[model samples]
Target: MRTRTTLAAAGLLLTLTACGGDTDDKPSAPPSLTEEQRASARAAAGLPPEPSTTARYRFLEALNDIDRRIVDGKDGKDDKAVSRGLNQCRSIKNAAGDEDKQVALVQQTLSRFTIDTRLPDIATPETGGEILAAVHKNLCPDF
Candidate 1:
């Protein structure tokens, strides 16, 4: 997961640089960072890699698109959201399809985000339910 995210960042940089450079001197080839090197690079940037497949990445992207008062799209905070999201998925799976348990798990997980929702502090249960629905539809359809 971390590798993929780091690669994404690095890939974007490589693509941008490769797109256009000095018209005089040829652009130098980009160095491919090893796993440890990539991990260090990601750590330096403080961005968490997307978890699981491209589906989960898209899910989080869509989730962040909402005004859910979360900072998952930010640099330092995205990792926490990814970690909490993956954790919630595992917890929901462990709940064995119990709706109440799943809802509660999501509510608990919501505390992990830096939210600025309609509520004063915590997000509404309805919001949590919506998040859970997205999770089910996106991350854990089997659950």
Candidate 2:
């Protein structure tokens, strides 16, 4: 069982950390939303909340173990990669235990994580399904 206080604290830290780095003259991109907002949106969509900050880092570390591309460059602080992984969790939660749904989400999201890196693409549903399993275990376990 988890506590609301813990979740709120983690959300605060995530927002704080995610707020760092220069935004001045930063190229326009999708507007950023805080972790709490993201989580609320996920919940509104009928998905489960993401893990704590510690768990998220652990999740990234586990994915890094599976393939370098997942965390290539930026030394695991790659915001895009991390978001991509968390988005996987959202879809995976919605997927429930349906193997095909999970596999398809992997196909859609996994390639984006791997492409453009020096490493070969980790896009295959077979491999992606395995990697997404790590996301499930660390961040969004069965509920």
Candidate 3:
């Protein structure tokens, strides 16, 4: 009986740990990028040539990744599906109302598509751009 109880406790601990309770609440700073990398991402997103701050650069990088994945034909082209998820994500970010919170929300939102098995179809580049736009419309419409 003691052994069984010990095993049960161990299993419970393992399950809780696997639930990702250790996730950081703080968002990490975006990585620094070379001018070429920034330019490439900007070009991919059709932005004008100019210096981009960390937030803009990270957003562009995320957009570029989606665009690249779409061109590579890795996912389906269901814009509506992507739009729905992105809209929800955008709402979450808007409610957060701070740059760090928004960044955290975006990271969490995007990570769900990759990590959550039961999530709906992944977003393609076009869909990803649309999703970004949805969020940016509220957060940085001029960006």
> Which numbered prediction scores highest in lDDT against the true structure?
2
Cα lDDT tens digits, model 3, 1-143, are 99999999999999988877556667789999998998688556544344235544444455445544422333543333344334444445355557766555544544544422332356334453454454464324443
Question: Local distance difference test, per candidate?
Answer: 0.61, 0.69, 0.49
Is candidate 1 or 3 superior in lDDT? 1
Candidate with top TM-score is 2
- If scored against the real structure, what TM-score would every candidate get? 0.50, 0.56, 0.27
Give the alpha carbon lDDT tens digit for every residue of 37-67 in model 2.
9978988875567567887778777877877
lDDT for predicted candidate 2 compared with the true structure: 0.69
Deviation in Å, model 1, residue 5 alpha carbon = 55
RMSD of each: 15.6, 16.9, 18.2
Tens digits of per-residue lDDT for model 1, 1-143: 99999999999999998878567987689998787887576445443333467766766765665544564355756566556565566666667767677657656655544342434454766666666566556665665
Show the lowest summed lDDT stretch of 10 residues, model 1: 111-120
Clashing pairs in 3: none
Whole-structure CA lDDT of model 3: 0.49
lDDT of 3 at 51: 27
